[model samples]
Each structure stands twice: as C-alpha cells, then as structure tokens.
Target: MTLKTEPFVLNMGPVHPSTHGVFRMRVVLDGEVVTDMEPVFGYLHRGIEKLAEERTYGGIIPLTDRLDYIAAMSNNFGYVLSVEKLAGIKVPERAEYIRVIMAELQRIASYLIIIGAFLNECGAYFTPFVYMFREREKIIDLFEMVSGQRLTYNYMRVGGVSQDLPEEFLPALDKFLAQMPVCIDEYDRLLKENEILLARSKGVGILSKETAINGSVTGPALRGSGVKWDIRRADPYSIYDRFEFDIPTGSAGDCYDRYRVRVEEMRQSLRIIKQAREQMPAGPVRTKVPHLVRPPVGETYAHIETPKGELGFYLVSDTSISPYRIHIRAPSLINLTVLRELIIGWKIADLFVIFGSIDLTMGEVDR
Candidate 1:
C-alpha cells in the first residue's frame, strides 16, 4: 500500500516590494511548509548585453555605472579595470589609491541602504530606513565633491579615474569615518539584539557552504554561508593587495549572519578608506588613453567585490572602437538563484527577511 501527500505551491514575487526588484519565486509547500522553490527572472530584461555591442569603448563606461547603481564607483572601477587590461594601460599609483578610497566609500553607503531597508521590511517601521539614508546623504556629498556628480558619476575612464580627488575630499571623508562607528553602534543597539529582529532573522533562510558556491553566491552572501572567499582578497586586484582588512564570515548562514557580514564589511571598508587616504599619492588621477580606443582582437573578464557581491565585466573586442560583445556577471541575479530555495518551508512573512538579507539591486539584476 502507498500513502498519498499533497503539495502547496505559491508565488512570492514579480510584484513584491521585498523581492528588491521585479523578480518572482515559485514556491511549493507541503502543509504550510515550503518543500521546493524556484526563482524566476527576465522580468526587467533590458538586453544590456546586446545594447553594449553597438556602443564605443568610452560610451560603455556610463552604462556600466548602471549595473550596481548602489556601488557605482566599484562597478565602474571593475569594468574599467577590464578595459585597461585589454588596452595594457598603466595607471598611476595615486590613481590606484584614489580609486580604492572612492570604491570603499561607495561600499559603505550601499550597505547602509541595505541595512536600513532590511530592518524596515521586518515591520520595524520607516524610522531605520530614514535614519540610514541620512548617513548615506553625507556619503553622497563626498562622491559629489570628488566627481562633481552624485549617483552615476561618470568619473572613471578606460585608463584611470576622470579627475583627482578634491582638496576637501579628505576632510569630508575623515569626518564621515569618525561618525560611522557611532552610527553603526546605533544600528547594533537598535536591532542587533532586539528580540523581534533576532527572531525574524536568526535561523531563517539558511544556505549551506556548498549550496552557496553551487548557486554562485558572492560577497557578503557567500560569507554568510561560511565561505571565506572574497574576490578582493582571493584575487587581490588593483591596490587591494596593499591593504589589510578582515573577511568576516558567518556560521549560521541565516538572515542575521548576512546582515552581520555586511555591517562588519562596512567597518572594514572604512579602515581601507582611512589607510588609502593617508597613503594617497600626489599625481594625475587619470591615465592617458586615446580619445577613441581601438583595441587588438581579444577578450577579458574583470571581477570586483562590489557592495552586493562579485561583479564581473566580460568584454570581447574585435579591434574596433566599439566592443564586439559585453557581458555583466551581476551579483544580484546570481544571488537570487538560492532565494526561493532558502525561503521555502518558511512563512510568507519571512520572505521579506530573506530577500532583503540577500541585498539586491534591480539595476544590476535587470542589466
């Protein structure tokens, strides 16, 4: 004789705010407990890869800025590094140091937004998100000072950065750094040990180490799953090898650990910025590149640890001013793979906690 069991399936996204963007999860449940889940994509497809084939080398920089809009500096840095590799351009030492500092600041700002937004999703109200962005505003101020534009600062060129750091940039950065520890402490005080947050996040959405890597998780999300792999340290590209910082890892691989990883990462990023600022060289911010670049027929891939995760830019050049092909290995899109898998067997309310903990951006995922 055989026994029969029924399965329940539900869709958690494609329109859910907590999904971070327009994405969906097909979940199968067994008696109010999810048994299996699959994450669906292509909702916000813009065919960016197809679009890149037609844009010139310089023109592609602006588009790269949109990939992980939160960490625009790092996105540009990683993409331009690939182009530089392809072009065999030499960057000044000062330019490398300046790039590191700006990228670190953007990392901190992006994490602040995720933390505030994650906390808000747990129904703690809007206070934290508002408070978080307040600090973010100051960081954006620094970016504006350095590049003359906030958000999508077209401040990176194929060879090096577009401009030198402003004279006031250091002072602003220092001031922001001094205040960050206190703000971090405030967040810890507000939600770290709070019973509600702890309950909602702890032991929820667990991802094992093997599963994390199998699903191609990176950055804090992979660390949360107990992997010590960080592209910045493992690969040590750019001036990252000159720096000393800790790669924080988590044991539980839950929402809480992911949250902690990013929080600690912010602290580490601050340390990198301070070190970079103190050691910043005095010279031109940009390397010399042709107004129009025509590279030898070749292809290269560059990966960097963005605020979200590993952001890799793959370019194929056919010795033309415009790239023959371009591909963005986006973190958000890859991180979402295990999203439904983690949320299954959990309550619908817990979906937001899991989704926000992964820390996604539509700009990158859609692109």
Candidate 2:
C-alpha cells in the first residue's frame, strides 16, 4: 500500500529573524522542499518618492539616508549627483576625492554586515558576526569623525560634501587601512574551507549569467553570476575613472560565489581608497550654492554602486525648488525578482541560506 501527500503552505517572514527585516516569503513546501514561493513586501514602505516631491532639493538628502540605511553614503552620492547634474553645479576637486574616500569606507562597513549576516544564517552562530561587527565599529568611528552620524549620514550636499575631512580622520583611516587586510585574511582562513559551510552553500541557488542580466540584477549578485558588469567600471562616475581597482566576478554563480564576490569587492574598495588618499589635493570641500536650489526644467538620472547593487535616482524638474517627480531604481526590489527562480528546487533549510546570500535590506525593498 502507498500513502498520498499534498504540498503545504508556509510563511517565511513579515517579521522573522532570517527574513532580515519585514520581508515575507509565502512558500509552498512538499515535505522539506520548497516547491513555489510568493514574495510579499510593502510592510516597511515609507513612500519616500512622494516625500521627495514635497521636500526641497537639499532637504531630500536626509530622506535618501533611509533607503538602504546600511549604506547611506552611497544613497547620498546618487541623489546629490543627480541634483548636481540637473542644476549644472560643479563639485570641488577636493570634495570629489573626499566623497570617494567616504563611499569606499561605507562599502567596507556594509559588506562586513552582509558577510557576517550570511554566515549567521548558515548556522555558524555568533562568532563571525561578532568579529565583523568589531571591525565595522572602526569604520563607523571614521564616519562619525567626519559626518557626525553613525548610521544615517546626511553629509553629502548639492555642490559638494557638508564639510572637509578633519585633521585626525586621516590617521585613523590609515590605521584601519593597515589593519583591514589582516582581518580579511583571518576571516578567509576561518570560514572559507569549513566542511559544513561547503556542504550547505556550494552550488546551491545557482543563478546563471543570462538570468542575472535579463533580470537586471547588478552589484555583487550580478557579478557572482559570472557577469563582470560594475557601474563604476562600465560607467565611470565622479573620480572613479581616475582611481585603479579591479571588478571581481565569480564563475559558479552560486551562493558561495556571491559570498566570495563581496569579499573580493571589499579588497578592491580598499585599493581605490588608498589611491584616492594619496592623490587627494587641498581645497574647499564645497562650492557656493543657493539655499533653495531650483534646477532648469529638465529630467536627469544618476546611479552609484551601493553595497546591495546599483542604486539609481531619477528626477523630473519643473524649474522649482522641489522635484516634479522622483523615482528610485532600488536594487533590493529588482534583485528580489529572481528569488522564485533560484529557490524552487532547494530545501526549506536552504531557503534562508539562499535569501541571506542575496544581501537585501527591506527598507529599500519596500521603499
């Protein structure tokens, strides 16, 4: 005699530890395997675009900080660059270098959380998370030294940065730069070869090159799929063209490959920062601009490589102090598009592993 079984429905989040934030995945499971998934979001939505329409051009900078809260500096850079391009404002050369420095530092801090969170989801306990958090504090200290805020740094401005780098910030940054490589090497030795981690993550949730590009997945997720497309390399913005760094790509396009891509990216970010520091010149951090900035009647779009992916800001101006329409090309939301395709054949236990590997922040996904 034989018994018949039916698929059961399970809710993964909306408020679960591994979901990362108010994200929910309605998964249909046949025993332990996930057969189908419906991703449900909007729990954390704040209507940021509508708010941007109401705020002054300068006032919207702080609003951007809330998008990818983990990497607010990148959000600031994208929005300010869009506004500057629309208004024809020229940033000071020194300010450009400072911007690059801050952006790279933010990148490192964001990746520490991402990799740490991924390992945590893999059931490695708190060891890796705590270690990465310790290093992240040093970078946060650097940001505080310059921006006066730890998480939501509203330091970027229309024509330049809010202020110049302080006297002590450089020496602190130098110390961090000197120590970061050793920490990275230690982390690699600790986790990369663990037999358990390998068994769980290797070749799981594979996203092909064709799928990644067609789905518009960018940043480390796209790079992990063997597509060497980086916004900084493909489309140079600010002083990125002047600096030297390599775009890291993965061949397997699996969960492990995504993890490896982020690790290599941190190294590349450090390289760019070192070059920017050496080439940094002395000058004012900002150019003079009116309190109420009204750009010409036009539309503009600008994007930056944030920790999650390519974050873009699009604006329509009517020659007013506020934008006529504003839209954000949020990578978190776009990357989620491919989730169903990747998780279909994996087991329920592998669900969170694959999800964490994507490195999404719900704030941006629901924004």
TM-score of each: 0.95, 0.99
Q: For model 1, how does the per-residue alpha-carbon lDDT over 1-367 read when each residue is reduced to its tens digit?
A: 8999867778877898677778777878777776778877778778877888888888888887777777889888988898888888888999899888888989989999999889988888889899899999999999899788889987888878888777788887889889999999998898889998898899988999988999999989999989999989999889899988999999999999999999999999989988997888788877778998888899999888898889888889999889898888999888888886787778767877888999888878888
Write one digit per residue (lDDT tens) for candidate 2, span 1-367. Answer: 8998878999988899988889889999998999999999999999999999999999999999999999999999999999999999999999999999989999999999999999988989889999999999999999998999999999999999998888999999899999999999999999999987898889999999999989999889999999989889898999899988999999999999999999999999999999999999999999999999999999999998889999999999998899999999999999999999999989998998999999899999988
Q: Candidate 2, which segments miss by more than 4 Å at Cα? A: 1-3
What would the TM-score be for candidate 1 when compared with the true structure? 0.95
- Give the runs in model 1 whose Cα sits over 4 Å from its true position: 1-9, 29-32
Clash-forming residue pairs, model 2 = none
For model 2, the run of ten residues with the poorest summed lDDT: 12-21
lDDT (Cα) of model 1? 0.86
Q: What's the TM for model 2? A: 0.99
Against the true structure, whose TM-score is highest?
A: 2
